[model samples]
Target: MTSVSRYMSYRGYQFPMLKYWSPSLGVTMLGVVGAILFLAMTLGPKPYYWPTDASYGSSPPIATRAGWMALALLPFVLGLSVKANMISVLTSIPHEKLQIFHHWTSYAMFLLALIHTFPFIIYHIDKGDMVKQWKTSLVYWTGIGAIIPQAYLTIMSLPFIRNRFYEFFKATHMIAAVVFIVFFFLHCDFRLSSWDYFIASGIIYFLCLSFSQVRTYLMHGIHTATLELLPSGLARVSVPTVIKWTPGQHVFVRFLTPDLHLLTAHPFTISSVYRDPDQAGKAPELAFYIKPRRGVTARLAALAAKQTGITKKILIEGPYGGVSTHHMSQFDTILVIAGGSGGGFSLAMVDEALRVSGLHTGEDESGQESRRRLQVVFSTRDTPMADWYIDEIESRLSQSTTLPGSDNGFETSVSVHITSKPDLTRSTSTLDSEKGTAGKLPPTDITTTGSFSLNIYRNARPDIPGLVARTVAMAHANPMPNGKKQRIGVLVCGPASMLHDTRNAAALAQKRTFGGEIEELYLHSESFA
Candidate 1:
């Protein structure tokens, strides 16, 4: 889908539109729920009445139908719960992107579960055997057992609670899920075909779990990760490995250290592009730029602060979820926007752009001269982070400039904005901001480094919409030589606020594409928070 359709929202409800579902996703989910309800209501007992036979007890036709419907949803819910699964492999959709569906499906199952439970309770009460059934029936006990954990899983999984108590929630979520599944299986008591659902779900969940475990422990194996504290208070993790990963992908790192997130595996985006060891004459390294928060990052930062370049044994899983390299190459122009810690994401995109355009290898592709343009816009409140970013950009630009085919017309530009007040006392040679007549921090434009231009602004925020519009306008101004409309790809990684702005901006830019001014306007957004 184009950015326009993906980010489309109804008037007067912009905030709610940003919560989870896009209009397309919302409609798809609505259809799913509607179909479930239709089947439940249509196939069930007409008045949802309790059977006259006392032997039937709480096993009314309607209750059985509701239970069966809930059972049918098990496979999908379980399949989407894992990081590595057949669903993702077969569908070409990443596990993370399927997370929203996983959550919604579970909610639907819980609702059906409630529907299945209430009927039994009402039937038992009407028959005046509620107390007897509660005391004697294993089914009643096991049903309640399953529901307690299910309720906990549902309520605790809410965004606010899950994000606020993430460490606690993550630790307990797995345990609770196992308990709920076990009790749910027992509650079914091998009722015809019920065991089938359990087996399906069990297989799907275990297979994915086993694959992830094997990849983490046996395939990628254990490696030493060196942690260094940057002046920006960000932790830089460097790991040498033969494993290759696409740009914009992330890996879950499990540190083998006690009292320091020993049991948890935290995900970090790889900031460096992978190259062949044989070709480069050394093992390729993966780098992560992590802003210290709480838990694992906080502990890692503390250790790095004590002694720079501290090494820790770590297990890595994945390299998952990235825009396809081929898809990215199809774009005539690539604009990357990042905020704070999202610098890593932006850096990776820039690296990929350079590599794809043959600027890094100095190999000129036939008929590809001046074919691609890359723009990077990064905003941060910290000056040190901005400085670090500037240095990294300069290094890349310098390398490209010295290459044989560097002047192939593959244009690159970087803009860094620091929202906080600049420290005038710091000694730096790159600062080129003109002195303000009043007490104001004016925008600073750093001198062009090598063949690329680098601009830095102090005490200012980026105009996200303006940047997007200008990039699209530039692409429109330079029509493709092939007589085809130009394509622009925008990648945004930042906090929710920044994502919201970029999302809307990209969506609005789609108007030009729809009006035949361009071929396409694609947007990929990642939320760092």
Candidate 2:
């Protein structure tokens, strides 16, 4: 076998288990949390500090200090919970990664609450005034109210419980959080100095959420979205909005017109072109490919399907995510791997690579012309999805070929794999000879009908590692104008297993020097869960 073929079949290197946990984010969080804890324990003014050896003597001041620390953590926990978070805006870190710090800080706050609770109780009991303290002080009762929910919140946040009952978890978590905040402030008796952080956290959350809501209203003005239910149990909802978003970013959508659960918004990746305007001076239209799963999506689909020309007043919360943009253009070649609905994210990136390459000109930081090779691999469970997305894939590829400064735009390839058997019982006897599928509507004839080609694989899935290796090899072998080291960016948005495979392949490639001695590989994943 040829060297290219040999390299493609080789299973590459795997990193140690700890690397999979995203060590950089972990390390950063550890340093920050440790510093905060150390300062809280050591540097704060100890107003109740005493040289007394008695346990009851130190309880009041230590508990009060811990209470302060717990309150201080509230802003960060709330900040990280927001989609349009200030920390992410400042740091340029994905909000998803920031969630790790959120979880840890919440635990820290819970620990502090525990620490804050026992000492005061010990002091009250030691003085034989426990019952009197509870009866006389609103602080004692309000503190109990705050601590109980905080403990409950932590219990309900366990991964297995959360994933199983997400809606319940979300509702209870929100309610409990609000209760905790209120009681926490009251527990401090609304002392502006002591309760200021909780108030700040509430303000931050309100501003972020309200800003997102107001922006959407300003752009779309209580927009009506047209929902068309497709045969594949997927519904396409298209809405015209004034805002433009980067490819692969998602918007949180709520169907205000729907009778069922109109308040709960769900995030869906924009499946259509990022900034396409159908006419001059018209609002850019956005589209979402939504599967009819349980909850709001399912209800929305059923409601839309029953009504002809269904239009709903919708709320769009954001054009969030797509942090991959920070480094996508730095690479010479791009490989996008996606599965099922996750194709929404991958396809957007594919479109972005094409759009930027066609539109970009002049020199880069390295004084090299804009040039890139894009390879798209989409795997789906059945043919209907494949058919729908494949048409979109072809249209985008064809559009790229004709765009201005697109001489190199045709340097793209699309491979679609369908894992399930086609419903051949519905197939017509006279199969379209041009397209391989025997069906009522044959797949697109890429050679005859499109400027670019699409390879459709049925009853099989592409070997993720092998395909990645071959693509990396091809990119490495191709010569760049400036002869700088080739960089390959592998962007995956799919099931966890698919992401794991793609990440593994990218990691393997990074270890080896490809055809060139200094070939580099970077992997970015968009995870819905």
Residue-wise lDDT of candidate 2 within 235-346, one digit each (tens)?
7788987767877778888768546556567788887555656644677778887777767778778877998558888878788776455476667788888998887777
lDDT of 1 at 95: 75
* Model 2, residue pairs in steric clash: none
Off by over 4 Å in 2: 1-65, 121-129, 190-193, 276-281, 323-330, 360-371, 402-408, 421-453, 512-520
Per-residue CA lDDT of model 1 for 1-529, tens digit only, reads: 5544554521011456536423333445565776677465736557576547546554777777788888999999899988897888998877776787788889878988988899888887988989998999999899999999999999998887888888888878889999999999999999898999988888988999999999888889999999999988899999999888988888888889886778878888889998878989999999999999887789889999999989999999997888788867777889999999999889888878777666333222434334577889999998788878877866765665575654534677788899998788776644322221222223454445446666677888999989999998988888766566788889988987787778777777778887888888888777676
lDDT of residue 304 for candidate 2? 74
**Count of backbone collisions within predicted model 1:** 0
TM-score of each: 0.89, 0.80
Assess candidate 2 and give its lDDT.
0.70
